[model samples]
Target: MLLILLFFVAMWAGAQNALAGGGSFLTLPTLMLTGMDARAANVTSCVALFPAQIATGWTGRDLSRGAAGLSLRTLFIISIVGGAVGAVILLLTPPAFFARLVPWLVLFATAVFAYGSFLRKPGEANAHLSPRGAMASQFLISVYGGYFGGGIGFLMVAALTMAGQNVRIAAATKNVLAAVMNASAVAIFLFSPDLHLAQALVTSLGATIGGVVGARLLHHIPDKWLRIVVIIIGALLTLGLFLRAP
Candidate 1:
């Protein structure tokens, strides 16, 4: 029954990834509810969501673009390197410490999402970021994506809007960049002691299905409402994590 529930949630998360990002906001907590430690759950979530992110990114590949002077190739390389560095940092952190830190991370992610979704004014569809700022922002977000990635989609949206991309293009670019960011982390986590293969596989199956279906439904779904729903979830999740017995 739990696994069944998890599979369905994974599907929702995958769909959310396709539509607005923040999939890990679902998977990380769901995985934790299964009794895995935070570090293990985080690792497993990263692996499980990788395929769905790939699918989502590929489906929207045509719309993706970089900042004014920064090419996609440059962003790609930055994501890879930054993600790897963050993954390495995660690898070295003590499990207990990470468990303690999960709540704070989730809280921060939730705040970022809220800002992007509600407070930030709509940007011009064609506004481009200054090249240097875009590159630096991409790297930092990549590092965060590799680390926790709960609200990465919105974070990318915020950054991309500054680079002259609209929400749609930002979503597409983030999907691709997200996949790239996780690629290096996945390589590192593939052999780690913390990964839980069974859970990861289950999520992978559900997320893949969701990614495909969600891509098709992207045009039909109300993105703002979905984001609002996700924000509510993130807030609740953040509170729950904080109140949870350490």
Candidate 2:
């Protein structure tokens, strides 16, 4: 029954990711209940959710866009390199250190993504940001995505919009980049000792199913309510993590 519960959690996480982002916020805690530490749970979640991310990226590829003066190719390269670096750093980090750090990381990502998702007015667009600036922003965000991606989708949306992309383009571009960065991380993690394959497989299956369901439900569900739910869940998870921290 525990495995069944985990599957349901994965399903919700997948739906949250497909609909509005913040999937990791759910997957991490549930993975922990299966006897993994914070860092291990994180690595496994990245692998488990990868397929769904790829599907989203592929389906929305046309809506993706480049920054002013920056080619999409350049952004792709940045994400790959940055994600690789972050993944290496994660492999080197001790589990105890990551356990203590994760709560704060989740809190920050959640707050930033929530702010980006709801607080910013849609009419306030900025498309003239320098390519160099956009390049730097993408690289940093990519590194974060590789290391501990909780609110990565919303983070990318915020950065792209700041770089002058429209919300629609920003959302689509983020999905593609998110998959790219996570792919780099998964490549490294496939060999990690911390990977929990059984749970990963179960979660992956559920996430894949949830992604499809979420896409079908996209038009029916109110995005505002989804964002609200994401925010509340993130806050609760953050509080729980902090309480469990040593």
Candidate 3:
């Protein structure tokens, strides 16, 4: 029954990831409820959703180019390094410390996503970041993606769109970068004793199916409504995480 529930949760998460970026909020808790510790749940979620990310990114490959000042190659390299570093940090972190920090991290990401999605003017959509600033933002976001990954999709979209990409392209690029970053993290997590392969495998199947569905929706959905939906998901995830925090 738990496995059945996890499969559905991952399917929802994959679609959310493809559409906007708050999928981890659903998958993490589901994993924890299945008797995994928080840290284990985090790692397991990353691993399980990785294939779906890759599939989604592939479906939107033409749209995965970098923003105005950022090159896809540079972003890819940054994601790789930052993801590895973040994974190491996650492994080194005391479980209790990570538990205490989870809610706050989710809150911060949610607030930033809200400000970007709702408060930013539409006229400001072409606002461009300097090369250094763009790289730094991507690196930081990649690190965060590796560590916990709750709303990293929203973070990536916010950063990319702020850096001058259209929202649709930003979302697509985020999918690719997300897969890149998590690839590094998943490599690290594979060696960890905490990972639950059975759960990961089950979730992976559901997530892959959902990824294809969501990727198809990317081009069909209006940009304004897409952003709104992403923000709503982030807000709800924030509230849920806050309520769950000890």
Candidate 4:
């Protein structure tokens, strides 16, 4: 059972990375169902996902030349602040608050994720964003990402579309933002006594390898079918969270 669960975790993480969304929608719940306590599951997933984010970010850069770099650096700075604030909240707030909110947030994220492919119009290939608008939106989404990253890719995609970027560019930026938020939260969680560092490390390694492979395959794939698959997964994830929430 453990081995099978781990295999599912790797494949799910790989597919989610390939699709440019965070895989916490799959990983977090899986970990919890496997008997990890909720907080520990969240923290462990954050740690495991860090390496995946790095791999995906590098892949995005390879695909987009310097464009990915520009967007990544911008999103990273905003995410750092947001993640730190969220970590503080997690440490201080009641777990019940977050528990009640996760399902609703997942639902909203799914809706946003579903419409992400259409956010930009035809021929708007370049990002025509004002620096101020991009920064502000990045900051806001970072807060959301830091708190709960289920559909953070969609939020970032929405922000990028508002800034007039194409789906590809939005995706690259989303990867960077997800990386920063997870990294920050993971760092904070490392000091916790309850975290299982060994399992987390193993999971992170799997996610990293999967992310690199997925990034390599992203451009060659037909995204319409991929998008449909992701929407279905997102809906399932959303329903699962709702059912699990207290």
lDDT of 1 by residue, 1-246 (tens): 767878999999988877776778899888988889999999999999998777767878999987657888999999999999888888898988998899999899988888887787664435556889898989999998888877777788888887877677887898899889999999999999899898999999988888778888989999998888888888888899889838
Clashing pairs in 4: none
Which model, 2 or 4, shows the larger TM-score? 2
> Using lDDT as the measure, which candidate wins?
2
1 against 2, candidate with superior lDDT: 2
Q: What is the C-alpha lDDT of each candidate?
A: 0.86, 0.88, 0.81, 0.68
Q: Which stretches of candidate 4 lie over 4 Å from their true place?
A: 20-22, 62-75, 118-131, 164-167, 216-221
Question: Ranking by TM-score, best first?
Answer: 2, 1, 3, 4
Winner by TM-score between candidate 3 and candidate 1: 1
4 Cα displacement, candidate 1 (Å): 2.3
lDDT of 4 by residue, 1-246 (tens): 764676568666866667556467677777777676666677777777777677666656643311232455556667898887776566565667766776787678767777665464554445455767677767777766666666677767666765766667666766666777777877787887646776676677667667667767878878777767667777897787778788
| lDDT tens per residue, model 3, 55-173 | 77777788888765668988999999989889989999988778778778767866766676568677766667778888999999888888887667767887888888888898789
Q: Judge candidate 1 against the unseen true structure and give its global Cα lDDT, from 0 to 1.
A: 0.86
By lDDT, the better pick of 1 and 4 is 1
RMSD of each: 2.0, 1.3, 2.8, 3.6
CA error at residue 228 for candidate 3, angstroms = 6.6
What residue runs in model 1 are displaced by over 4 Å at the alpha carbon? Answer: 123-129
For this target, which candidate reaches the highest TM-score against the unseen true structure?
2
Q: If both were scored by TM-score, which would come out higher, candidate 1 or candidate 2? A: 2
lDDT of model 4, residue 132:
72
